[model samples]
Target chain A: MKHYQAWCFDLDGTVYRGETAIPEAVRLIGQLRDSGSRIFFITNNSALTPQMQAEKLMRMGIRAAPEEIMTSSIATAGYLAGQYGRMDVTMIGEEGLREALEEAGHRIVTEGGEAVVVGIDRQISYDKLAAACLAVSAGAPFIATNGDLAFPDERGLVPGNGAFAGLIGSVTGVQPVVIGKPESHMIAEIARKQGLRKDGMILVGDNYETDIKAGLRFGIDTLHVDTGVTRKEALAGHSEQPTYSLRSLSEWEI
Target chain B: MKHYQAWCFDLDGTVYRGETAIPEAVRLIGQLRDSGSRIFFITNNSALTPQMQAEKLMRMGIRAAPEEIMTSSIATAGYLAGQYGRMDVTMIGEEGLREALEEAGHRIVTEGGEAVVVGIDRQISYDKLAAACLAVSAGAPFIATNGDLAFPDERGLVPGNGAFAGLIGSVTGVQPVVIGKPESHMIAEIARKQGLRKDGMILVGDNYETDIKAGLRFGIDTLHVDTGVTRKEALAGHSEQPTYSLRSLSEWEI
Candidate 1:
């Protein structure tokens, strides 16, 4: 199981529920760490920052250093910074967006910026939409973290970045180059960040469509665990064919 | 509830499941029909032909007439016919694609003649991909049905039409204007074919991101059921709320 130097895990359905911790998941992480495997949680959920994710992990009895978490928001900001340095960014988001950009070495500003970086702006207004469209049309590269149209939470669901991307994509005639899980950029970043080769990196998660298929997209070994949403019958019939299937992540032999 | 004269429902996750009758769903359709509401199903699943879908509906007790089902393949063929009469389309598809084009007056030949119509060529060969790419590069307008990157099945997940679009989108620098649900084109066609008016036409489906959201994209009311890839939690949090949330098609009140 530790044949790969690094192990990438997915959050939400993988490590924890929306807010609750998966005890077995925490144990598996501990096992991985004891085995000296570099652990990283590559999640597409862009709503939270890495610090928040690390804090969540700590709360769940899974010790994750701040560097151990790489979110779509961070990856997107990283990709943007790699493209252009210190560019003006018109943000339509929360603190995560601004912090990610700052961490990625880019200047974040309000209006008349060079680039429009839109995240899950829950308090989105028509005025903000109009402003974003204007920024995008004026040559601001509309950088979206992940293309998740909707995100699941305790409250139900919220329109994720993808819905906003569609609106801006329609207006700007430009689509965001997404930089999150399911895309090679995020996968590559995790691989590079942990100094682990992409070869033989096992991705463990419950969601077959996003987690398992994302592994396939990036060419990695996948072990799908039936956590929150997946059922045994559904996992049994998966044509996506994960390397291993487990009722729980703890079942895997370390 | 029957305020609109026409209603366009999507098949697959909308009306019935794979080879099974969503009986309550069928009953709802009957009620709508008895109430003088016209119904047509627009499906992007090009694996099955429109006639096949129509037959499946009848077998499932939905009793959809032959003219009531509209598949993306059929719509693609319709698109090609008006643009190029008896045009040679380099197909990356199955019998569904061929039948749709052939019935719509298109001559699917080798690599050259007029246009190259690419469909969900599951058994994608290098030769087929090359031909499709070459034809598109040679100035054929690329068209796709839906942007679904992966299709979840009983066996697992496989690349859907969105994969082909990604390939095409990667090349040619022009994204294919997808013409299926989520995109207003197919919705408009279904509405026109079913003799459904824009008003009072409610879309019932499981997937909020695609089905419910697609219905909304077309200016139609949506009824979200507890089904599809998107979970109840995800749908609940989304600010872009659907009109009605029913536990199942059975819970739908007239």
Candidate 2:
């Protein structure tokens, strides 16, 4: 029942699932925009660029600018830039992660570097993993875009970036610094970049583990909708409860 | 030291490190062969076939027949053969694993098989991993050739087959049945194939964790050398010690 200055929404299960957009979520987002609330689309997908995500949202009748999207790739780049400034980075990811890192003034290399950043790479090879292991074992800072082990596809659940990062961690005996929920790096990046206070921001998502936990960790209010991953019945299992839990975004009044 | 009917030697570190053979080990193995002891080369490297391993040993002055070499690939195949007879297998590995599985009467497939077998594959791709993850998530049995997380290469320690298997495991929440040194499957295979009793077998290696532990778990005598991993000083940390520890193979009397 409280109005927030910024409404951060998780993209995958909150706004859309695969190719189709949730009508209730789309309608709610439009109402929030009309009410003069800042909208941010946050996602753990490091494969697609902000422009690509915005285009997808536009096709679903949701107006979103590239600057309004905060993907894990962008958050990873921003986190690295803030932590160590611009330096050589060994990267294992798709075009989005590469572009984000390069845009942040970090040089990508094949082997030794100041940091080893990993994301979901569909074209992942053994050589790339070997190089990452070697670099991480050599004491380079290891960073992962997200820690999702498996994600759903048309066929079934498939290996995600977190699985690959876990492999590297097992081999090198080093843990990577994760940049996605529920670590709160992306939420912090959004707050810092937009000059918004955590008290004035509310994260709305369907997943309790990633989205809701992220908001709680970042000291922001969370609204959980039972449209995706976590069902309404599963909320009782978690010790920490979200600020608001609704069956759908349609139940929320602007 | 008592003479045994069978002498099982671990390939890397015990007999040879990289390309060079340990002179003391080579001399002792020759003496053991002359003394009419059955010699077996046991290795967790699933990349190389038994014939290739035998040839490598032969070139190092240790005469070994293909039947005398028991690789993790061969052990895995043998294990699968005994457990399920002949079944369609989804494989993610190199030539050795493929050959061994096929030779054991199992048909290799890309996905949706009775089981999923993984090994050290330098040509590993994300698609292959995705397929394996899907298969395992679909309720197929997951098997790994070895569980060595990292192995030393020319540059440094690189990700091993276990790392990739662990990745798939993380994605599917399935623990792979490892057929390698620490598990005693390879040693069990040698004993079953040769009709040798556990009392008549003695495992020789430098690594206490894998080699010695395999021998101990298999109820056989174990000889640990200090020429490779698990230094003599470090052996004190382990609760279960090897049957015998020596500075070199030259210390053993024929």
DockQ (C-alpha based) per candidate is: 0.02, 0.88
lDDT of 2 by residue, A1-254 (tens): 78899999998888998888999999999999999999999999999999998998999888899999999999999999999999899999999999899999999998788899999999888889989988898888999999999998899999989999999999989999999999899889989999998889999999999999999999899999999999999999999999999999999988
Runs of candidate 1 with Cα error greater than 4 angstroms are A235-239, B1-254
Candidate 1's DockQ is: 0.02
Predicted structure 2: lDDT: 0.92
Q: What shift in Å separates residue B42 of candidate 2 from its native position after superposition?
A: 0.5
C-alpha RMSD between model 1 and the true structure = 22.4
Top DockQ hit: 2
Location of the lowest summed lDDT over 10 successive residues in candidate 1 chain A: A150-159
Judged by whole-model lDDT over C-alpha atoms, candidate 1 comes out at 0.72
Report the lDDT tens digits of candidate 1 across residue range B114-195. 6666667656554455555556766777777667765544533445666566555554445776766677666766665556
